[model samples]
Target: MAKDKTGRLHVTVKTGGKRKLSSKLWLERQLNDPYVARAKREGFRSRAAFKLMEIDDKYRLLKPGLSVVDLGAAPGGWSQIAAKRVQAVEGKGKVVAVDLLEMPEIAGVTFAQLDFLADDAPEKLVAMLGGRADVVMSDMAANTTGHRKTDQLRIIGLVEAAALFATEVLNPGGTFLAKVFQSGADAELLAQLKRDFAAVKHVKPASSRQDSSERYVLATGFRGGALR
Candidate 1:
């Protein structure tokens, strides 16, 4: 590692036999990313913690004494932040995380190895939470197929499902936030959110790579009850 003129560390990975150029480039990017280094030093699970931190700083979403539900919460970075902000560690609030993959325990977060897409997931999460949630957040992304259209569609489907689940589980005037890509499918989702929530907006945190199309849809002030 060498320091550049701008005082940023630059790491170059040597590509050899069996090491693809893409993999080498990706490793180099990760090695040089400030957020990745910060996450490691600060004990967060992944660099994605910064993204949520940035968003919440601006939006004031997470608060003490609020129940939060996190969907697709593997690796638990977002859950870690949620738990801390909501004071779940001190038992002032509740944070429940669900993912298809198993996650290690966080002090205040309850982990569930369940798929959010399952028919029973919403009910189960409500039961675990003991009531409707003050906020429902999802950082879920579908497995990419390498094709842009297919990947966009899959991600949209996941966001749609997450939105429906939020409607079912969020308390009146609650908030819903989810990761979404810049794609045509977002129009319909935005329209639906507008109807269900008092305010809806899109946010792209500075922590997110500029080249990535990923953005978060934030909806607040839920109308409550079933969507017509």
Candidate 2:
């Protein structure tokens, strides 16, 4: 370990190992990331818990007695936080989480191994909540292909699907929040959101990586009609 320009001891990975350079870099970043350590210490599933925590702190989106749907909720980071905020443990509220991968159960979270993009997902989620939801949030990200434009479009497509699902299942005055990246291609999504919601804006939580272009689109006050 040697002190870098920031005067913090930086652990350098040996370059000549059998590991690929990309793998080595990723391991190094994971090792150095404070949030990753913090998450382990705090018993949260992943570092992504803080991103949702920060966003909820500012927006007051999750509330007691509110029903929430979490899309792409593998490992249950956001679902954990949402379950607590909505008081799901006491049965005052509800949190329904779904992902393409199996998630170990979290307290107060009803989990399903299913893809959010499926045609039946909306109806399934509404049934889980026993009705409409007060909030729908997605942190789904497509696998990165190292091609910037292609990767951006993939994530945008996920956000679009989540947004449309929210429009279908959210109660009047409900909230929709989804992860998106910085790009001009999101303008059309924003336009659709503005038509369906009273307020819409982009949110970059402090917990997000500074070098990353990742941001979230938060839409509030659902007008209730799912605009086609």
Candidate 3:
């Protein structure tokens, strides 16, 4: 490891033994990533916590007394920030985290290991939240195949599902945040959101890697068109 012009330590991971070149490069990037190190020091589950932190700091979307739902919230980084901002552990708010995989417990977060696409998911989440959610956020991404178009379609499908779930579970004037790629939310999706929300925008936080195309689609001020 050596310090670069940015004064950050740069690491080199040589492809040793059976390690592929791609794997070596990935390891090297992880070793040199500042957010990864910061997450460890700050006790956050993943570096993704900083993305939500940065977005929330600017938007003030999370607040005390708000009810929140985290879709596909494994590893619980976003949930941690939501809990703190919403004061969930203090009983001033509620946060429900749902994922297909089991997540270790997080303070002030209720974990549900279930697919959000299931028929009863929206209702179940609203019940867990003790009322409609003031915010529904998702950091979920579909596992990518080598095929770019297929992967993009999968991601869009997931985000669309999350948005629909949010509409069903969120309170009037609520917010929705979801991770998206460089192509951004599809035009059709954006049009629907424009009708449902007072504001909709695509945002990339400083914590999100510039090299990565990942960004977030934020929609606020829900008009509440839930069917039962």
Best by lDDT: 3
| lDDT, residue 217, model 2 | 89
Error of 1 at 38 (Å): 0.5
Would you list the C-alpha lDDT of every candidate in the order shown? 0.91, 0.89, 0.92
Error of 2 at 68 (Å): 0.8
In candidate 2, what are the lDDT values of residues 1-228, reduced to their tens digit?
887677877878888858999989988888878899999999999899999999999999999999999999988999999999999999999999989889999999999788777888888888888989999998888899989889888888878888888988999999999988875227889999999999998899999988878888899999985422
Write one digit per residue (lDDT tens) for candidate 1, span 114-180: 8777888878888999888999999888899899889888999999999999998899999999999
Of 1 and 2, the candidate ranking higher by lDDT: 1
Arranged by lDDT, best first: 3, 1, 2
Q: What is the TM-score of each candidate against the true structure?
A: 0.95, 0.94, 0.97
Top candidate, metric TM-score: 3
What digit string (tens of lDDT, one per residue) describes model 3 on residues 92-184?
988899999999999999999998899999888887877789999999999999798999999999899999988989889999999999789
Q: Which candidate model has the greater TM-score, 2 or 3?
A: 3
